[model samples]
Target: MAPIFSLFLVLITEFSLATAQQRNSNISLGSSLSPASSNSFWSSGSGQFAFGFYPNGDGFSIGIWYATIAPKTVIWTAKRDDPPFHRDSKLLLGNDGRLILQQGEDPEKTIAGGSQIGSSASMLDTGNFVLYNSRSEIIWQSFDAPTDTLLPGQKLRQFEEPNELFSSVSKDDHSTGKFRILMQEDGYLAQYPADSPNLVEYGYWDSGIKIAGNNVTLNLDDNGQLYLLNNSDNMKNLYDGGNVSDKLMYRMTLDADGIFKVYSYGLNRSDDDWKVEWSPNSVHKCDPKGVCGQNQYCILMNQEALDNVVWFNDPYSILSNTSRPDCEDECLKDYDCEVVLHKDDQCMKQRLPLKFGRQQNDPVITLVKVGGREFKKEKQSKVLIASVVVLIVAFTVLAISGVLIYKYRVKGYKKLLNSGNEELIEDVILRSFTYGELEQATNGFAEELGKGATGTVFKGLISNGKRVVAVKRLETVVAEGEREFRNEMKVIGRTHHKNLVKLLGYCNDRTNRLLVYEFISNGSLADVLFKSETKPRWEERVRIAVNVARGILYLHEECETQIIHRDIKPQNILLDERHCAKIADFGLSKLMNLNQTRTNTGVRGTRGYVAPEWHMNLPVTVKADVFSFGILFLEIICCRRSLDPDLAEAEVILVDWVFDCFDSHELDKLVQDEKVDKSKLERMVRLGIWCIQDDPSLRPSMKKVVLMLEGTVDIPTPPSPSSFLSSI
Candidate 1:
């Protein structure tokens, strides 16, 4: 009797806790919940859906999944690329209306944000997490952002032939997979290789709908029917499942096996839970468009015979080619290449025993001779041993040198103090902190903010909740890394403009190189300008443009040492609470004596925004930065990215399109924001055209640019910009 009573009590307690999760549907601002605590999730009113962390890899990913089963099926994830690094993680709704994910006592990352003040978050009974503004309007919702899975009532919009969705790495692995259902430029939705977007459009499963317009929606109904909603409000059935019990919930998912499927399931969770209702492609495992081994073909006997394939001990990565969008070029450019196995543009070069399969087909294989010699792998073990020995010796040397460097740095600072130069000492110490202090402030570096080629940034709180700062950790601390570190330090020490983000402090202890800066409530300019559903007002656009020009003007002139910002683009420009622009990321900035006009250097800036001189290898100057700013200026007015894929053939390049609009007397079409004053808008466009001229001699200086934007200088009739159409 005692044992029975105890079991009953345990079941009752678990039920009560689960019930509480549904009733308390709110996650308040500045607070976080973690799955490791057993109460980190909130359930829908009927307990049908739940939002929490799903454990995978070294850490867990924050996702919304079905809660009634043993193995949860994730419907959506906040950050597919950046997942929480620990079990003791929490999801926080910040005061600024951003959805932040943080690992236990670690740095925090902003996964999603609501662009409204006084907004609050609620996990709705319909499995939607919404951020509601003060007027009770939804500022942001989880439904607007979909991952690999799509639930009933959710819609995928195709305003401009949108292609967005990725597959899970494997049946058990939730990382990136090679398959995707994408919308091609030819008005079709098909399953293609995720890594290759520009290959000839081919897929095993396509919607087969040839529509006349781009405004359409792909949605699933409660009865397990997939339909397309055109510009009209009518639904056209694409795939029908006849009839299923209305009680069963259905979901469409892009699985790891490169198959898109719709499955039906219900509560109680039977052994064979998910019932497949619809599959566009054949159910055979080989029918799905999966990646295959390089230069290898299967006999296609049966599933059992699939295992009778060869593999290599040392398999390289997806041998990617930087010159082209697809992998074909990478295989051909390599010295040791013998065969290029290509499928949807994804290539695998075969040198050793072939690797990979479950890739849908025997790839379109192409073979080529390298130096007219055959390939062989021998003495591999000896090669690995020698590599390890060299690495160990190199690390030892770096460690010894690091210690000597640290002593000199500390000694030099002490000398300033001993010499009684209080100003110099104060300046150095004011922007200095021990590595441990930053580590503690960031809770063991748990939350990642953003990552770039050079370093990764994390969100941090200091002064006991008073200050929020962004902390950047460089990938390495040697050679190029050291140069970037000192360059930033020198540039930041001299400049203090209102449009420049202030550097709070820095950490340089041994191999660790970190920087701390004030956190602007609003994020990057690229973030605001590139959103598919939202656009900035004309007034805000002009303000941001003028303010950014002012910041650049200050760097070029008003400083004690003239600083040339070599990289000036939307991502490097940040916005503050007032929506004012601030130029950040000074790692690429160069200092010159007041009279120096230009200097020679290698290519540096991003692909789309780099100056034309980069291609010619001419002496780089401040005009290079001016050229980038001009491109960004055009992007702001048009409300389009520099790399837009939705334009007609004639308007393929943004700069070329602008010129076409000017020549055709279709300036009205060039200005998208209706509220913009036409004369001012045309003047702005003309200024942008002049700033991006091919001849550095023709492009206006930054000082004159500020005057032109302010309506102080007389505007000039701009000529056509030199043709520069290079792909990234």
Candidate 2:
């Protein structure tokens, strides 16, 4: 009878404990609950969330999650690192107010703990799980640490702090895998080291502005206004373009694939689907790690170049040959240098000659302070010399006034003739062609030999039946202007240099302007140098480069007004049937005095081939034209474009690489294109390298380039060019 009574007492004690655990909604110290209890853990707000034992793939944990959904989603977990030991898990509120997770109905398997009694857990409406201790003090909170998503009031920390990263999705999973966010020193957001620092990526605002903060509340509206909230009191408007009212709630997350996107949620959708409202880093690859590549820029991808340059002017780089409206057109065509590592390492501009009519550098000014006594002393000496010269000049002027008028008219006529008015007098050297005659002779734009960035060249036969002519229709708006047109005929018609393409006649009918020249059956120097077959031997290439240089030298020194062809490239150098080279394309050419250091105004020329000084919009000199000729000299020796994809791995820009080769003794390697003769290859390579030194002062003059090619004078040892290549 006593044994039965003992059994009943044991059963009652166990039942009483279970009932107390189930009824204890008001959590206090020393309280305990079993996983089987109906109301073991209560959340702070509406029963939308509850904290209790939850089972994952193989183990169980104490987590807080939304209970309203059909399939509950765990928002925050307590024992993430240490899961329950076995099937039996119990939740206990200890005397210190810390929540403990114990396993298997045994006291030995307690794995993890939480906050003190009065501050164990609270679920905010924003979906944050905060843990507080006694006296309503918060100890640990889920808001401070995030997993995959950002809530409404929470912040997506900036990327500045070192080693601040996000934790992985799981111990076995290395993804989302410790994603980090902190305010960067550059005041921007960057993701680093998925595997290594060399493999990191960066992101910024559409305006190219960097973001800096500990936390950010990215608020989006149906209208596309994005607000980044630093905290409850501090906030900044980030963007505004989308329709925000479309959804009740939105989420912004940084995915494992280095993709940052924003998604919208609504009241109607039970499970919110992520919509990629913005992808900040999608097109950021293939360029220098933090920079956009070459002509490739980080415009809004939707904004115009003129509009975007104002916001992000520093990274705004324009490659050669790129026009304004089509800023990214060429960049989009090539995807080679898309993902780059260093911003400064990305190639921007290359070596090219300064164009004619550019503004020259400012003159150096010397400022000195003059005392009152010094100024008075200098003034007395100037007055004495001025008085004697004035009396002598006055007597001579009285005798020569009548004679001076007669001579002035004669001098004016000579000036007009030099200005090229001689074309009006057909009896003079100048010749003219009618518009109808040229069009018919050319067969209405017959077989075009080639086209340039500016104009087209067509092969034509003259009506005389004995001579063949190549007709060029200068494709410039002012090509047929009465003044310039006459000037071209007068200057070119008078010159008779064998190295120059002969100007037979010109047709100017306002709209129809054409230039007829002695036919060169062999097209352009570019075609032969870059000839499809590559049959031109090194000696022949050397011969052609020298001939072109001689032609330009004649124009600069021998011609009446040093004619600078402003645009000098291989195509501008035409080849005759005899393979003799003649310089062509003088529409953008400039005529200036021999003594001038530079010509100012009017920008014109091809990119990559234009000199670096030209970018400053400085006045040009004959040396500028010489610079272009030098580039042409190099181009002829090496059969490749200035910018070639084949050499991208080496980052070998034509000019810089040539200079580099000169330093490394590997210059001979550039001549390996099967067509070059190994015997003369070394000489030709040396000649080419000498022509493309980065410093303009270091490059040989055209006459010298011609002389060196012919072995007339010993070529001097060029400067190391270490500094010049560094600028690129």
Candidate 3:
């Protein structure tokens, strides 16, 4: 009778949970949270805090903050450093006992997480979202990784290990800004600009320094006094807030102007406003230099005539002293640089929407740059802004994107001109060619190089007949394709990477979209790896990896605007005569500009090479490319494809299979050539694993990845490849 009653109770509990999930009104595991979902947010039982995604800048951030506040005061972001743009993002309390933030339908990026055992997560009244273990003990808490705001029970610390402890988020965009409060090596709390990974201090107080311990921890209480607990043992007064009411909530926030302050919340009544409680020393009083980025000077503001050259013109730019049109033309060429100023031959440019006011003013007259967004729109507006073009979502048996190219140039623009649009013609950097000219070069489509569903390629000779190029003729036009073409033209026109394929020029007519590229004699990496009997030497493989890493780093860090390459695989890696890697296909990163069209329609990547984040629907960052590179690295060295179902004895999955070799200490077996340097091979293996760590934070930046390959830095042993479940 007791067993029967227990079964009945279990049925009731299951039914209740099922009902709650189906209603889409509660926060729980298996619940889908989205901007479009009705149950997008989860509030604590007391209704003091909420956990969900919110609009931030041009993107969105999954965060936890005060529920009752206007404009939403965010305290913690799952990925404070990397937020997802407007797209498909999801949050999950996984059955594996972890909390995951998914971006753009990619499940691989677990942006933030806790223990992955028998743990459960919940939003508590204390404004802490936490994960609990089997015994209900808190295993991990959001209070530990505070971004800009500090609630009552949170603590900020600095470890003896060199690391950036806390950084403030931008007040406008909610992105990581310049302001930072870090625990110095001497145990003095100081503020610095978050420009680099290494700590650079702006100011520090010597009186409160505590150099005795290995680490220092600090926290704020409900009463508003900030205190330091050295070694978590000795308590010391850092800031004494006299007679603060306990009923009001006090928060310490770092403002966008690079200042730290304390604010007390309103009383029980609605009319009370927040009051300032405490602040840092005199360092934050003035507008700090270096906060306004480089290539600009800082001076005291006076009452007289002053022009902020950086603010009025642009931030980083160049110019030549020719004519007013030429000077402004230089500034207008910059994608985002808006303002232009010129005097004599010294043309100066800057970006508007300045962060700080400058005291010094230049006499140069600043004018809105020509060829600006307005000018571009006016020029493009002449061309027919066609209705949204539809594309068929279909796939064939062969490649992820079956499109390939051959060398040819078409006199395509002549055809557009012949269409009776003479006044619409304008001088552009990328030239247009006629279809007859291309047909003459390609020998009337005689040489069929490659064919895909959407495009076809042919081999062709230039009018000079000295050099050859690859000509790809796109068959259809889609909204995404239009965006991709524009992005590709804008990016490759200015970018010059030794490891990146050069875009020679392109032709744009209504139906046909053709692109010309420098032809390479050798085929893609896939063709060589799969067809050739002799494998590429180990040294060559290492060089290719480093070269590819350099190109990726340039796009992510070195470039003015960050570029995230959604697809990275061997097929897209073109090989030159020297066996060097040149990343082909602008379609890779350009597609990232558009939100995922349909979950099942678009090709995220080739099946095995796609990162887990894409599958889980998480924020796609530069790390997505790193994950693919890791797979490529292993594939190149191990002489095996990522997934080969035909293999016997169940050795198909490359990452899992290689890690199995690492566990057995048979990593040396990866190499085919005995002449390969053992130390270099070992470094490559370790670095590859490091790049593919399950957590995005665990993956090293491309800069560090290059240094490790160059033997400038030590490579630590990598954790196991993050396939949650597998068997040999």
Candidate 4:
């Protein structure tokens, strides 16, 4: 009798505790949670949804997820790209009505409701985590700031600041992925690659509805019906799962593979039971614009010809061929050929990085050149046999010639020891060329390449016309030119990087000061980015930007003595034959000792690309170079000059215009017709804004800049850059 009484009391207490938690679903102010704590999340009244820390990677991410599901499905994540926090991190609804994330000893970061005050928060059954005011008016909600998934009853309003949903990285990793769905202002619901431009041509899928009003919206009703609504009260149903029961759950998601899908599950069913209710018209996975990576092709599973596959029309060469097989054979023989399109006895060969590829069921026969892996294996076996035979013969010869080799090595060592220091220096380091030699190589400096503030560059040939070089001759050989000539020689001679132009030799005979560099086949970045009729591809531009950043990083941190390339504009960035960017013109570079970090210097950079500190009479550091690189980064993104007078009044200054667009959530204006990755563009834009901050301390280090550009680190929202300019 006593044991039964004790068990009854225990059951009653447990039931009471559960009832209390359900009733108090509206979390009171000052409530806090932690991943390490047993009560890590706040559950909805029905215990179906929860809001708090969830295990992600090796750490925890704050998000709202389906609590009852076996594998909890994350619907919304806070700071998706930010690194996950450790167990010590706390998510607290502060007494001051702000939701703050406290990660150990780091600065307290506000998750939401920074500006508005809240009285309480609630994890609603509808999957919304909302903050309420004193009168219980909703201040902010997770539904308003979505990440990846959309629940029933959520509305993706058109013309809103952020009417888009980025897919998760994967089912296990909830970080922002490589695809997005946008409810555009032009009354079209479109899907594009995360990094591609927001132009119509770049979109892989879109709703065919085109209306001329801003009242368009994408809605998901509680009945599992997905649709579009306009001001006329007209509804275009995308998917109708008529009258779903309350026990059923549904979600519309932009999948990681660039597919928009609708999924449904029964509350009583097993956790893994999820049925696809709707998906875009039986489209092949290869129909998307960016499904395949660069220099790769998408093939149908059945070996059937793609319905309507189209590649970028920019063919390097077009030839008349008799048959399709002949065209394929021709492309396979040509190493430069990446793709070949055969139609009506015409063979069109395209280079690598086939762009704008999609399925359209066209009549053309497309053949992609793939590597012969089996053939390589066979060739490798033959080479292995040859190498073994060569090694045996070489070993036999070496064993017989050992005495002779020893004598020759001893004689060479004696000669090296007897050589003069001057001779050794000339042999190991830079070669000192005579003025007459440089004149002969340059053909009397007749073919000029370009002219700059300090020197004129001429195309030249050395080593009997086998090696091409660019010889730069100092202009006046007076005060500035003399300083520049010596500066360039001293700075560039010691630095060696793949992205830095190589210095082969120098000539400083009397008044003739010249420096010879490896000739780059492609023109300056400025010419390719802005002056050319056809802009370089977006991927190429991104690679070029990273190349330049790495080169700058090497100069600022990796060198024996730190150097700042004061002028980091597009004009000073040269492209090699492979379109690799190389930093040129070290004339304005300033060297710093290992111990020194800052130096007082006058302004030495181009007008549009100069750092603000240069004009403030402040001592400059490596951050000055970072600032210049920032301006150059923006130019590379938009393929426009920093300062253009022939543009609109508000858009004259590139920085001012870019900040305005970013602030207004109109970054689409920057790359109007260009195809780019939207996520990368935003990341780069944020990084660029940070780099150009007025305060040097506000800018990230060159190493951090490289990481940010390469998508390794998350970029935070940058403060307005126009404040300092306005004050000025």
Q: Identify the leading candidate in terms of lDDT.
A: 4
Candidate 1: residue pairs that collide: 105-443, 106-443, 107-446, 107-447, 108-447, 290-359, 290-360, 291-359
- Give lDDT for model 1: 0.65
Cα deviation of 556, candidate 2, in Å: 1.3
The residue-level lDDT of candidate 2 at 366 comes to: 11
How far residue 413's Cα lies from its native spot in candidate 2, in Å, is: 31
User: Candidate 4's residue-wise lDDT over 153-249, tens digit each?
Assistant: 8888775634899988778788888788988655668787786645444566777654444468888877778898888888888887655455578
Tens-place lDDT per residue, model 1, 1-728, is: 99999999999998997678644765667766676787777666666778767777777787788777557778787767654457766777778878776554433565666466636677776667777777868887788877787778877766432245678876566667777876433334566666542222224456656343446677777877887776767666768844565577888888776778888886645664787778775434443333442333222332322222222212133453322224545654666555444333445555533322232223233333344443222111101111111111111101110001112224322322344233233334436767998998788899887776558888888655445788888774344565666666756765667798867778877788788887877788988988635677665687799989999888877765677777788888889876789988764345667778666556766777889888887877788889999999998878777766688776667888887887777777865535445677788889989988989889999899999998899878899998874444
At residue 360, give the lDDT of candidate 3. 32
Against the hidden reference, what TM-scores do the models get? 0.46, 0.40, 0.43, 0.51
Q: What is the C-alpha lDDT of each candidate?
A: 0.65, 0.51, 0.60, 0.74
Worst 10 residues of 3 by lDDT: 399-408
Q: Tens digits of per-residue lDDT for model 3 on 626-704?
A: 8888888888877678787777554777777777777787777676445455566677788888877888778888889
Give the TM-score comparing model 4 with the true structure, all chains together. Answer: 0.51
TM for candidate 2 is 0.40
What is the number of backbone collisions in each predicted candidate, taken in the order shown? 8, 48, 38, 13
Over the stretch 1-728, how does candidate 2's per-residue lDDT look in tens digits? 89999999999998886555434433555655555666455654445566666656565556665565444555455545453435456666565555665654333232233322444445554566555565667665566555545555555444211213343454332234433333332323444423222111122212234333434334434444555545444655654545545644454554433344565444476565434666554223211111221221222222222111101112223354434223323333333222111112232221111010001122111111122111001110001111221111111101110000112212322322333222212223346788788778778877897777666778787634434677878776444459876876777776556678877778777776777777777778778767657446555676677777778888877666677778888888877755788888663456666677776656667765676667656656666676666567667667776666567646356777776666677766676634444435555556655655555676677777777777677765566543343344
Candidate 3, superposed: residue stretches over 4 Å from native:
1-28, 57-59, 81-88, 102-105, 160-169, 197-208, 242-246, 268-273, 285-289, 299-728
